[model samples]
Target: MKIFNLPLSESTFEKRAPFYGRLSATIEDMRGKTKLVLRLLLLFVAKHEIEATNWKIIALWGMG
Candidate 1:
């Protein structure tokens, strides 16, 4: 007959595994979201500048 015994106490790393995983996941998500927002903001600014430049050109043409 073979007898097996499970661990009665958690190791230090095991005890902290969930906390570390959550922290790492949160950081990764935040970094991805930040990058996405920054890209969107940059695109919006570029679009706004293009529209403003077009308006300026139209105004200049009207004056000439």
Candidate 2:
């Protein structure tokens, strides 16, 4: 899933899968949510890997 990028166990991911689906009933909103999550993850990863920056991330995964 293009949902979260963190040290999450299988149980935790599966536990929240239903809620992720509940982000929206429309296909467009769901897709947007996925893309937004991925973009945020890419930014976080790039900041740490490419720029050699240190970040302490505390994430709450959901639709705003």
Candidate 3:
């Protein structure tokens, strides 16, 4: 098996490394924001359901 050595410049590697690092960090930040939004949405839905059930109970009791 022949091993092929790829030529890479020091400056090119350095620039690309930092660029990829920043891109990865941005992706992580976006994921965190998405998770937070999903959690908030779930909490809001749960609260809305609870309030709806309570209103239904109140209406039934008032009618009787």
Model 3, span 7-47: residue lDDT tens: 38887767688777897899999999999999999999999
**Tens-digit lDDT track for model 1 on 1-64?**
6364434567866877788799899999999999999999999999999999999999999999
Q: In model 3, which runs have C-alpha deviations exceeding 4 angstroms?
A: 1-14
TM-score per candidate, chains pooled: 0.72, 0.40, 0.69
Ranking by TM-score: 1, 3, 2
Ranking 2 against 3 by TM-score, winner: 3
Alpha carbon deviation, residue 19, candidate 2 (Å) = 20
RMSD of 2: 20.5
Q: After superposition, how far is residue 62 of candidate 2 from its true place, in Å?
A: 42
lDDT (10s digit) by residue, model 2, range 1-64: 7765643788977887777667545677878899999999999998778544222222222321
RMSD of 1: 9.3
Q: State the lDDT at 24 in candidate 2.
A: 44
Pairs of colliding residues, candidate 3: none
Judged by whole-model lDDT over C-alpha atoms, candidate 2 comes out at 0.69
Best by TM-score: 1
